[model samples]
Target: MMASRILMQRVCCVLVRDLRGSSSYSSSLTASATVQPFLSRTVLRSSCRSVSFNVQDHDDFTERVINSQLPVLIDFHAQWCGPCKILGPRLEKAIAKQKGRIAMAKVDIDEHTDLAIEYGVSAVPTVIAMRGGDVIDQFVGIKDEDQLDSFVEQLIGQ
Candidate 1:
């Protein structure tokens, strides 16, 4: 993939250079016209996997979850929790179905105990939906795919 992308970039550069001499348009405009589609395609490919992410710290949480324009589902879980293991993937799948409509922040309770406490998480696999820094909804324990889907749908609706 990297090789192909590099090759494509080289080809585009050559095309832009050739067009620079053949056309009356400015070289910058010619280069931009040649590169815009490639840039957009790369962005589209990356956006598919940008819906979910792991929380790093309080500051990271604030930046990603609290400040997000899109509604966010904060998954507070622990590595040692059995139910968390079950719900994590199901939550991700549900979020994936929503595409870029919403985002999920996976917070490991053990790593970020302060966040769990602040969010009132008393159990593993606690899913909290937030929009504009305010909590909209939440649930504890594992949920089936249908339930998760409905939960995400409800979040998006709000």
Candidate 2:
């Protein structure tokens, strides 16, 4: 029953995305009803993951990434980019393997254009590793799990 409810909610989310421009109050209400559980589950997972998060704004980025005690990995990506979608989960898995040795900040380039420009991110799926508020290393493109692990290991070892 819960599985079906979740599936139903997923379908609603897709519908909402497609109908975002439409001014339908009923659609909005249906989405609100269906999305609560999905949002709750997402929040629970994010909290449990602990080391991964989405960047909110410039101030948030400065506070979380620049001022972080641990090394931070910044993932600059976009929703419309296919490679960004593929790299995101793989990067999360790689970050998880670190056991909190490092942290990840997911920055949507479209939302945070300033940050992307400041970081010189001309492409999607750019991963930058920073320590002591300084960029230590960066790469632009998709990397295999092994490569990601190696990158994280290097960052942590620094």
Maximum-lDDT candidate: 2
Residue 145 displacement (Å), model 1: 0.6
Q: Which regions in candidate 2 have their CA more than 4 angstroms from the true location?
A: 1-49
On a 0 to 1 TM-score scale, where does candidate 2 land against the true structure? 0.71
Query: What's the lDDT for all of these models?
Result: 0.84, 0.85
Model 1: runs farther than 4 Å from truth? Answer: 1-45
Q: Model 1, range 1-158, lDDT digits (tens) per residue? A: 64465456556555555655775535555467755566446543344336788887899899889999999999998888999999999998999898789999999989999999999999988999999999999999989999999999999998
Q: Can you list the residue pairs that collide in candidate 2?
A: none
Clash number for candidate 1: 0
TM-score of each: 0.72, 0.71
lDDT of 2 at 138: 100
Clashes of each: 0, 0
For model 2, how does the per-residue alpha-carbon lDDT over 1-158 read when each residue is reduced to its tens digit? 64464455556555545556578744664668665565455532344336887888899799889999999999999999999999999999999888988999999999999999999999999999999899999999999989999999999998
